[model samples]
Target: MSTPKIPILMDVDTGIDDSLALIYLLASEEAEILGISCTAGNVPARQVAANNLAWLELCGRSGIEVALGAEVPLLTPLRTTEETHGPQGIGYAELPEPRAELSPRHAAQLWIDLARERPGEITGLVTGPLTNLALAVKLEPELPQLLKRIVVMGGAFNYPGNTTPSSEWNVAVDPESAKVVFDAFSGLPANRQPIICPLDVTETVVMTPEHLARLAEAADSSPIERPSSTDSHGLRSQTSNPLVRHLVDAVRFYFEFHFDHKQGYISHMHDPFAAAVALDSSLAVLRPATVDVELAGTLTRGATIADWHGLWGREANALVAVQTNPEEFFEQLIERVGAFARTIPGI
Candidate 1:
């Protein structure tokens, strides 16, 4: 019997990991990418859309709709992390100029229209802030019921914040939008709840230099180079495969950023793991909760609090992923992406 294909719509900020998540979906035979919605987070909405187009062009995949969303959060001034994801959001990996045209539709409209067109069949994967998705929910209250599921990579429940004392970066960037999305999902069926891939679970999924080498080897790419902290600050990949080369250049920056923060030469493969879970929820061990984002306290704004024990007396609005296996995830990422890269026309 053939494996079931998942029709997925991606909402991303095109961070380093978001790029990887997009590529992983492209690599997977099971993912039928319906479209992509870009929001401002890692860099900017326009840059995010550009990264999406470049990646699609690199993988020789085409005709996917790429739309730009709001440039700022619902209620706050925009903030971007060029230091973390590089100015263009793909590290040192310079991509060829994209030849495809951007979708004329807005990201919010894309979300609303696609959900209406493919209700109960499309799984939405959001790997950035919640601006676009929140707007869609506000426009169409039935959107929560329309999507088959939403896999979100935000929040930091049960984990320390990477941004503030209490908030994850994505949630910290736009807490109001996050709150809106969670509130809209209240009273939805268990299947309709968003699978929250918060920092609690996502940060534990680490990517190391060895994993990069393994991926290159799996692709049969020549000159496998495992990036290290001791390497020069501007080292770039010289592999024969264009895909592996750009990936190495991109992830090396992520590894360096983590190392500089004393987190070792490793990157938390947050978004790609969420991408995998969007297709197969079994990849994560989930626990239902009433997930809400804090928007008021001076020190607690953007913090995500989970009512794991039903203390709130309301229905659980999200399914929070509490645990996942890093080893199992990396193995599949390597095997699947490596094989897929081999099939793409190399530069």
Candidate 2:
């Protein structure tokens, strides 16, 4: 039997990992990307949208619509990670100017419209701050019921944060928005709650130098297959496809960052792992929990407080990922992405 295609809407900040997540989803036959909503996180909202478009164009999936969302947090100053993602948000990877235009509708409205159009069929994958989603929830209070599932890549849970000792970058960038989103989902039924891929789980899913070498080897060995037509739609394919090369370049920076700063050579598969789990829930071991953001603590602000033991006697609002099979995750990523690279038309 054929696998059913999952309609998905990705809200991204288009950082290095977010770009990887987009590539993974584009390559997967199971994902029917409905649209991509860009927000401010790793870079500015406009830059995020541009990166999304460039990636989609490079992947020959530019038919998908891209929209720009919140330039800053709902109630806080915008903070970006240009140092982490590099000036262009993809390290040394260079993509051609995007030929596609951003959709006129704002991302929040697009989310609401899409959810209303196909209620309970669209999986909303958020790989950025929750600003756009928080606004959507406010505009459409029934959004939780409309979306099939919401997968978020944020928070630190029980792990030390990349941003601070207690908070992750995504949540820290926009704590108020995160709080609104968490509270909105918390009031929903158990089944309608979001599935959070916090740092506690994502940090465990690492990509080593060995994995990068393998991907590079695959790209080196792949044959160049160009399309017959020279139309604008034709993709630029080559033995060293842009996707693979870009992944290598971008990840090398990430690997170096981890090595120098975190004293490790392996980069955490944070956003991509969230996308993977969103596509296949069986990839993770999730535990029900009531999660909230620390809003008022001076130093602990934006920290995600997960009630793993139900100490607060509150109902579970989100499913927190605690375990994942890294081997399986990498295997699936390589297999799907490698296959997609081989089909691209000429460099």
Candidate 3:
């Protein structure tokens, strides 16, 4: 019998965690990636697009469609910090230049087309600003009904944000877009499961030293491609040389960025947590709740106020992730990485 097809669409900013999530999704036999929509945040718009393409190529799954999303927030200025991904987004991978043509139809339009083509069966794996998604809903107004779910990596319920005191990076980048998605989702009935992996739950899981070492070991042993004189590290050789040197460098830079800048040794696998939860709902403890985005406030803009107290007797519109089984998630992540590693050349 043929494997059952699980269709998924990804909206990402191509950060290190986003790359990990991509790898995880590709490794799973449960999913058939329909496409990836690139947005801006940790990297520049163009670079993030390139990073997405490079990852697709590296996975040997170049048939996946890659669409470029909004470069700036719907109602806010574009914000990018190299702190998380270096200037290029994939750390210092100095990724090979992408020659692929950008999709003519903007990400929002592409989203609508995909939903209209395969209504009620496509899952949105969102890990960046919701500009493209909001644009789609605002333009069509009937898309929410067609979506399987929106797995978003944003906001903060129990934990503070990485970008601000009360705002997560994805939402903080575009609160207006976030509000649009939340409102549209709320307008939909409870049948549509809009699961949110907020910072509170995501931060609970971090890239432990052991996990990083394992990932690095995978990269070191892989036969993946390497960068040349034009790439970041500028190393040139092919005889018994590691092809995934760039991946190891990316991990090292990611760790250093967290350690030196955040004063934390381990960075939260925020985006991947959302992806994992999206792939397998049983991996985390989930609850149904109503969530609202704070669009205006001196210090609380972009805050996701989840109503778990039942103080207002409000109906629930979102599924809030309360907890996760870290061991299970890590085990699955490691297994996927190992599989990819075994396919690489020159350990």
Which candidate has the top score in TM-score?
1
In candidate 3, residue 260 scores what lDDT? Answer: 68
lDDT minimum window of 10 residues, candidate 1:
184-193
lDDT per residue for candidate 3 within 1-347, as digits (tens), equals 77787788999988888887887888777878898888888887777888888766665666788888889899888999787777788765655666566677778888899999999999898998888899889999988898888899888887878788988999998999988998888856554669899877887777755675565455455334332223343232232223245555565567667776755656568788788877777787888888888987988998889888776687788988889877778888877766675565553
RMSD (CA, Å), candidate 3 to true, equals 4.2
Candidate 1: list runs displaced more than 4 Å: none
Comparison by TM-score, 1 against 3, better one = 1
lDDT of 1 at 44: 89
The TM-score values for the models, in the order shown, are 0.99, 0.93, 0.90
Q: In model 2, which runs have C-alpha deviations exceeding 4 angstroms?
A: 219-239
How well does model 2 score by local distance difference test? 0.85
In terms of lDDT, the poorest run of 10 residues in model 3 is: 234-243
Q: Global lDDT of each model?
A: 0.93, 0.85, 0.77
Q: What are the per-residue Cα lDDT tens digits for candidate 1 across 6-125?
A: 999999999899999998999888999999999999998999999999999999998899998989999999999989999899998999999999999999999999989988999999
